[model samples]
Target: MGASSPPRVTGRLRRTSLVDQAIAALQAEIDSGAWAVGEKIPTEPQLVERFGIGRNALREAIRALVHSGLLETRQGDGTYLRATSEFAGALRRRTSCSELLELVEVRRAIEVEAARLAAKRRSDRQAAELERLLAESAAAWRAGDVGRLVGADVALHTEIVRASGNAMLLELYESFGGAIAEAIRTELLDTATYSRPTHSALVAAIVAGDPQAAAAATAAALDEVRIGRERRSIGQPSR
Candidate 1:
């Protein structure tokens, strides 16, 4: 009798067996916080037994997570978690310094227009909110809390964008906030001395209901960001 061919590896079964299921199972463990950040995962034997997966499948899953920045493997030690959320991990892995600088420019474009629109359209309540946010941010700056200052600065500008009365514009700004914050935090300590007055000038323009002044303030604020980025790029001491 002719030799029987080995079992064919059908596409459907292969799809179900190795790649997708392993990735999904591992990612679920991460998303559910089964493994906390900086915590080491189970050894290969334990994972293989728990998941009923072979060493090969478990290794593939580990490799995928490491590539995604969710985990890191030490040469001698076990794999360790690097981030809490997948999106945050992926964002950290993907964003380069040059890309962050480009994002600053994008923020400048959105915020400049939003400031003008806000000056023209903000209601009294929105104006009050802007003032309060700016005050919180300035206080954070004066307290030498760069972390809190970054949060407040993002909040105040986000509020200004909302006051523009354009839903789409607000959505875009909200989506980009994470990336912008990452960029902002890089030089925030060095730039804090300038940021307080720059943000104050923006709030002043918005409150005065002068579109031209608001636009100019936005420009000035973004210029400071640009200068900060350039200093970091060239390794100059932040003034």
Candidate 2:
């Protein structure tokens, strides 16, 4: 928490052509879960119609997403979503594997402090958003949809970091989000998905302004994820 209030946008973003607008629109729909990873977007004609933009703008948008690794076009098969975010796409393109544990460690270091700051400074609106994201994560857990769970879980953590009001922290956490989601899917997909109370408890602590509790909760949640990854590495049972 700082003495100054949270930063505000002083002015609207500069207006752009239909191509930029289409790009933003497409990313918004994708981020909103309109299409899960690996799903094909509507056909080009359908997208062109949906966005009410010319073919050129839509194609430019598609190409940008493809370059960003958010979408992939297969010859004769149509363009399919490959990753949910640019960070995730970058992760997939890596020729060398980054250790998942290393990623989790960085996340733990960032999120623990973030949680404390969030508890101190989160607005009621931010708390409500955390509640909504928590419910989404819980629902994904209930459905046993690991993919959805990963998205919702990452979103929850990212929201907490955002609420901390630290732009740098938020950027670091976002960069790690893809690997964190991957770690969850790899390590906790089978076990501990519901083994402990996590998002709910963290939300409670933050909303209550209990910074200590918030920090404890975040560290515990990340530790649980790390332990799961360790258990798999050692060929131990999830329990």
Candidate 3:
């Protein structure tokens, strides 16, 4: 027997790995708008053939995306694209508080400079806007509207950064906006530490065009939030 023809080296090539193929195909479809938000995706078998993958591998890829919040599944219905996938989820998952504190430290550095610029460059209109946001914040606290208070707090800080008239500073501030907002909501607004007087001081400092005062006021407010978080931690019952 003629040495069994070197185990039949088939000319047909194997395609990419199943998981990568599935991810690539799905990503392309999403990028092309083939799978728009709220639109159900094709069944598993369909994806298997489309990406040339086995059932198990295809399911694994889909499950990964689902966990990432890029895809949502209903019990009876098919999977669909989520309207929005928060990048913050990834950040929170990948980084510990110590890692994030480094980022916050950087923010402290930039915020000081931003406050200085804001004091020098803030227009009358910007000052008025900051005042309005502060007023709303005070009103929200008095009315015990936690949600509204958080919104006003974010708006107030954002306005102050915007008033700095430095696009780069504003962009840096925006990068942390979501994290800051969540922090305020959970630590400040949820606790009784935040009060009308705290917001009033911040507003007054910004309106007075005093960079040192603005920085000092913000530091104080954040100190209160930190203290609140520490208190909650201390109050937690032993597991």
Candidate 4:
């Protein structure tokens, strides 16, 4: 006879963002069939006790899972399991600020050349779209809408890649869009200042057909963003 499988044990979460860690753990449990679809999850007290997390933290985790469609809440009934798994769910894991800064660096590496090529080859339509996206990004910032800012930032960079006239470069940038948006959203939290090489300057360089200036402006802008994130992480004021 085959040996019996060992009893399952949920690991204790360490000190960090308890809500985020709880969300990850609960999602894994749902994926592993610890809670089947259509079945209600444990009571709030049970979950809080089981996870050794505060009530507020566990509730926030449940709320996030509900938002992600992995779970659903009923009116005074209970939260029911929804999805067993999600494609790219692991990619949605909460990233450390430093890890997100690394993603920004990677994205900058792609966009620097993209900006250079765009300066050399942008069409009138691509230039117009880039300008529109920059305006929208600035508007979103002024309105304190981080979500809109993320979308606008992605759109502007995407337009630059499109203007590069290189299908492979555009494809590469497309693949990184979602992760880049996630990082940017995290990095911009509580950041009231926009970085150097303002959108206008970058666009002006591209409009002037100056590849070197465009690339330099792109580097400076992304480096400023990176520095801002580093400062945020260390609790230092951004320069």
TM for every model, in the order presented, reads 0.64, 0.66, 0.59, 0.61
lDDT of 3 by residue, 81-112 (tens): 65323353243333333544444455567666
TM-score of 2: 0.66
Higher-ranked by TM-score: 2 or 4: 2
Please report, as a residue range, the 10-residue window in candidate 3 with the lowest summed lDDT. Answer: 88-97
Tens digits of lDDT, candidate 4, 45-104? 998888787887788888887776667799989887655444222333437786778777
* Winner by TM-score: 2
The parts of candidate 4 lying over 4 Å away from their true place are: 1-94
lDDT for 17 (candidate 1) = 78
**Model-by-model lDDT, in order?**
0.79, 0.80, 0.67, 0.77
Clash list (residue pairs), candidate 4 = none
Task: Give the clash total for candidate 1.
Answer: 0
Candidates ranked by TM-score: 2, 1, 4, 3
Clashing pairs in 1: none
Best lDDT goes to which candidate?
2
Candidates 1 and 2, the one with greater TM-score: 2
Candidate 3: regions farther than 4 A off = 1-87, 92-107, 234-239
